[model samples]
Target: MNQLKGVVSHHEREIAELRADRELAVAYLKAAMESLDDPDERAAGLLALRTVAEAHGGLGAVAAEAGISRESLYRSLSPKGNPTLKTLLAVLKTMGMRLSVEPEHQAHA
Candidate 1:
């Protein structure tokens, strides 16, 4: 009984760590989306989205959550994928996130 209890406790700790890591991934993806402004943003966002999707299970799982076809999610979030606003929003929403716009910094005269 003591050994069983120890095993359960270890598993619980592992699960908690996984949850924290997943939350970090989600936060990083949100930050990446907010930082988009140049070609780099697209690249970074795609990578971040892919990482989050993989963590949640993969393209198929993410597609299901986003209410899109698996193939569509794969194509859109690929490194070369140019996702539409609708697709982007859907994926973010499925990940418990939303997009926000902030004012750009003023350029020097």
Candidate 2:
């Protein structure tokens, strides 16, 4: 019983750490998204995606998490590549993030 308890405790700790790491990755992605209007937004987003990919493991790992092929991930997140909405959502989900929208404000005269 004591050994089983220890095992459970260890697993719990590991889960907590994973959750924290995931939160950090989500924050990084958000920042990258917000930087989209900047001159280097594309590069920044790619870098952030790469970092998240590395953290989660690698391209293959991220692809697996996204339920797609490694080649697909490479193409979708590539600088000149275009990805469909489905692919984007899958990748975001793999990175523990999601898409959201907010209303844009109109300019006052």
Candidate 3:
């Protein structure tokens, strides 16, 4: 049990550190979001956002920057969360990111 706990803690720290690199974090999250057709990918994307938030300053700081309560931020970032566009955009903005769209294919149908 202690070994498992240690492993979890170690991984959490690694994720926190990995998110320190904005480019990597953005790329990772963008890739995750790009796979939205898969349920697991959606969950992974949300979790990635949570991890990035943790790296930036944890939920409390993110919530403060986004002008939302910490609990709300946590709930919004949870696996089952379906945050509104406003909430999503606000959180992303606080993280120094914005949503962008590009053609899915080089040639249009």
Best of the candidates, lDDT: 3
Question: Compared with the true structure, what per-residue lDDT tens digits does model 1 show for residues 1-109?
Answer: 3354345554345434444686676666767676456776677778667667666566687789888999998888877788889998898788777787768779999
Which of the predicted structures, 1 or 2, would earn the higher TM-score when compared with the native? 1
**Rank list by lDDT:** 3, 1, 2
Candidate 1 TM-score over all chains jointly: 0.68
Task: Give all TM-scores, in the order shown.
Answer: 0.68, 0.62, 0.79
The list of candidate 1 runs beyond 4 A from truth reads 1-19, 106-109
Give one digit per residue, the lDDT tens place, for model 3 in 1-109: 3354345576576576666677888887688677654776677678778888888778899999998999998888888877778888988899888999977856757
Q: Looking at model 3, which ten-residue stretch has the lowest summed lDDT?
A: 1-10
3-34 in candidate 2: lDDT tens per residue?
54345554345444445687766776777766
Instruction: Report clash pairs, candidate 1.
Output: none
Q: Give the TM-score ranking, best first.
A: 3, 1, 2
- Using TM-score, give the best candidate's number: 3
- Of 1 and 3, which scores higher on lDDT? 3
Residue 102 shift from truth in candidate 2, angstroms: 2.6
